[model samples]
Target: MNSDQEHYIQWQKKEEERWEALCGRCGACCGAFDKDPCVHLSRDELKKYYCTIYENCFGIKKTVNGNDIVCGSIRTILHSHWPGDDCCGYKKALKEKN
Candidate 1:
């Protein structure tokens, strides 16, 4: 692969790790509070929340209860309101410094 491709791979890996770290596994944004959650939502034995299809999670997806909704990068929802969002590390970091 070219240097550019290698750089992009490294960047993407870093970005994904950053995104993973930002979540507290609180599950509110996944529809936990609405009595329905995305079908892709899964939990380990410890009950930590995660997306089953995380790599392809962006786009229109259905809730476990079958409600259709759009999914996008967290950046898109940064300004929106949702449950458990208060636990978002990225949002907390922004709020604390401003």
Candidate 2:
């Protein structure tokens, strides 16, 4: 719309990109190390993990074993424990920030 609105939108996009960039794509959050990863989690040729339905990942989903899971922001589970969480980039960033 206006110049200020445009600038704000651009800044918001940059922030979102920065946040997304923190992910190492290890898929631990999706249950990779737990041996029951999300059904949409896929590994690339480089051995990195990614979500097949990333654009619409938030909400109810399923695990490889057919377990129902509630998907949401990584921030929501930051304080919780996962199998490979010690290698999580976001947790490392927060640790460094503090």
Candidate 3:
């Protein structure tokens, strides 16, 4: 690729990393506070939440209570409300940007 294209690709990578870093891992979006979290949601020793199948989490999935859910990009649902979403770093960042 051309030098300019390569530089753009690198910049895009950094932006994606920055966007991913904004997630506080609170698991609220995964239904943690609703008491029916995603089947793959997991917590670490530090109490941080993660997805066991994050690499393939998008698409149809089931909650712990056997409820069907469709997983997609967080940006798609940012305007929607969830129980503990006030603690979401992504939402906070977006709010600050506006």
Clashing pairs in 3: none
List clashing residue pairs in candidate 2: none
Q: Give me the runs in candidate 3 sitting further than 4 Å from their true place.
A: none
> Which should have the higher TM-score, number 1 or number 3?
3
Q: Model 2: what TM-score?
A: 0.92
- lDDT (CA) per prediction: 0.81, 0.94, 0.94
The alpha-carbon lDDT assigned to residue 13 of candidate 3 equals 100
**Residue 26, model 1, lDDT:** 74
- Write model 1 residue lDDT over 21-81, tens digit each, in one string: 8778777777876777888888889988888888888888999778986778777787788
Candidate 3 structure quality by residue, lDDT tens digits, 57-85: 99989999999877899999999999899
**Residue 40's lDDT in candidate 3:** 91
Error in Å for residue 44 of model 1: 0.7
Query: Best by TM-score, which number?
Result: 3
Q: What TM-score against the true fold does each predicted structure earn?
A: 0.76, 0.92, 0.94
Q: On a 0 to 100 scale, what is the lDDT of residue 51 in model 1?
A: 85
- lDDT of each residue in 1-98, candidate 2, tens digit only: 99999999999999999999999998999989998889999999999999999999999999989998788999999988889999899999989998
**By TM-score, highest first, what's the ranking?**
3, 2, 1
